[model samples]
Target: MSDAHVSLRDVTKVFPAANGGEGLHALGPVDLDLGKGEFFAVVGPSGCGKSTLLEVIAGLTPASAGTVEFEGWRVDADIPDGIGVVFQEDACFPWLSVEQNIAFGLRKTALAADAKQRRVRDVIDLMGLGDFAKSYPAQLSGGMRQRVCIARTLVTQPRLILLDEPFGALDQQTRLLMGDEVLRLWRQTGATVFLITHALDEATMLADRIAVMSARPGRLIDVVQTNWPRERDSRIVERAEFGAITARLWKTLREESLKTMALKGAGQAAEPA
Candidate 1:
């Protein structure tokens, strides 16, 4: 069997309108390959199709053309069990307690009750949600809610995890803390991750390689490899290489952001009153 964990071969997605008008072309004719157990990050300006790319990989949305393969099989339908997703929104069920929410997916599968319970408890403890396990979603802070969501996903032991702007709602300090937590979880699980974020610094800190995209109808502009040590501490960000990588990504994105803005302005000017 082929070893590529995730592969997008000239994939393209277009959204057809209800009125039979011209469709919106969202992505690809782009090629991407993610090796097994790699922490890959996709970074670009907002609306540059990064999230769309993630959705295609997760099988949440289908591509209009080309192929998406995960673990040597084509991803042609709804999300499969081997893939876990953590979206920006807190997706926990409101009525369930934190522990119940985390255990929800596991209970639906074929795992034994005892095994499910053990997995849920282990994730709750790992995520530091032991004290809040009995608390409802309404009782937790935003960061806490996100942690519960992540723990829920982790309990499934997925082969690939897709994170779409997972820390976008948190404050800077909390975002950093959550990033560290996510890194720890990935290391523990050894699952391949494909993260979508606009934060260049976050990408620089977490990614084994960062894929930078072009403006709308996004294409891969560059892929930057990060050679930093695997055991990253907070102080690692202070290193000269950290700033250098951040600067390189920023510079690439800056040009794309400008082009996107200019294209948007031109489109608005062309619209007839």
Candidate 2:
């Protein structure tokens, strides 16, 4: 639909095999629609092309077939200003301080210097980094570093934010805290959030809907909607309903994971579904 913030129809990706010829189909014939300002998650086994799906949506990589559109415009390598992306790694540059890194994306923009700096300060405050705005990445803890990365993306004022396993490197406690932080940011920003993660609990807690992908030649096998309130917290997992949702996610993922392992063992590509 035209109002969809993001859309992917029959999207697919393939890579040439190491020895050459025919190539390995890694993902798709996937169809997805992300509504304006919705929080969505994609989950699957390790080699199931979760990141590939995200990158295609981000315009970081081209889809081998089908279409990707954002706000009725077809997506290409040139991502529009309305999009922001955060990967699993802490992408903060060593030479840049917290505020400087957050403002980096605005470097080539036409915004006035003071206005650009104001945007950076706003995000730092919003992310609870007011104290560390002048500190370098080396001065922060892992969780704090990730917060800086997120602030950097937020400062860009993106309408659609894509995160690929953004908290995968954090400790369990920190991951929970970061997840809460992400939700708060989402509420404040009202961006369409698309997160990719292997943690079923994370998906259950943060996603309005979660799509489960099948084995490589990845296809979205199912999409599960949750009833979590818009204002989410880590404690949501304490609810019995949360456990049920996570259990269902695990059940869908396990079958695909076993199939992927078997195919890899036999030196064969997973058949496209």
Which candidate's TM-score is highest? 1
Model 1 stretches astray by more than 4 angstroms: 267-273
Q: Residue 93 deviation, candidate 2, in Å? A: 0.4
Please give, for residues 1-273, the per-residue lDDT of candidate 2 as tens digits: 767889899998998788888897989999999999899999998889999998888888888999999999999756666888998998889899988899997876789999998888888889999999899999999889888889888888989999999999999999998999889889989999999999999999999999999999899999999978898798999999999999999999999989988878776554454
Q: Provide the RMSD of all predictions against the true structure, rounded to 1 decimal.
A: 1.5, 3.3
lDDT of 1 by residue, 105-206 (tens): 686589888988998999999999999999999999999999999998999999899999999999999999899988888888999999999999999999
Model 2 quality (TM-score): 0.95
Distance (Å) between predicted and true CA of 185, model 2? 0.7
State TM-scores per candidate: 0.96, 0.95
The number of residue pairs in model 1 that clash at the backbone is 0
Deviation in Å, model 1, residue 25 alpha carbon: 1.0
In model 1, what lDDT does residue 17 have? 80
